[model samples]
Target: MTQMTRSAVGGRLSDDKRKAIALQALARTESIRVLAERNGVSGPTVKMKTCMSRG
Candidate 1:
């Protein structure tokens, strides 16, 4: 599992926000690094978002 921060992606992103990010990641509109940077999180967290959405 990727290391998750307590307030990664801007002071704890909401479920909906995570979903949006996941969707974007899945759609290939945003790279994990880009999303992570934009969201103030780590690259693995972006990957986790897409993975967890499928799980």
Candidate 2:
């Protein structure tokens, strides 16, 4: 298998900060797709971050 580059992991938001931002976006938005697009990240990533924050 080919090795993945660091950029493949996505942008430089830290775990804590990412969770904070994702939560804020979720509160203000109704759609994960819109939030992800606005935040320049993937929908599943935002979902994962939000879920992790809740736990």
Per lDDT, the best of the predicted structures is 1
lDDT of 2 by residue, 1-55 (tens): 1113222443676777687656875686568767666566677777777777677
TM-score per candidate: 0.74, 0.62
Superposed Cα deviation of residue 17, candidate 2 (Å): 3.6
Error of 2 at 27 (Å): 2.2
Q: Which lDDT values do the candidates have, in the order given? A: 0.75, 0.65
Off by over 4 Å in 1: 1-11
* lDDT, residue 7, model 2: 29
The TM-score that candidate 2 achieves is 0.62
Q: Give, for candidate 1, the lowest lDDT window spanning 10 residues.
A: 1-10
Clashing pairs for predicted structure model 1, backbone only = none
The local lDDT score (0 to 100) that residue 23 gets in candidate 1 is 91
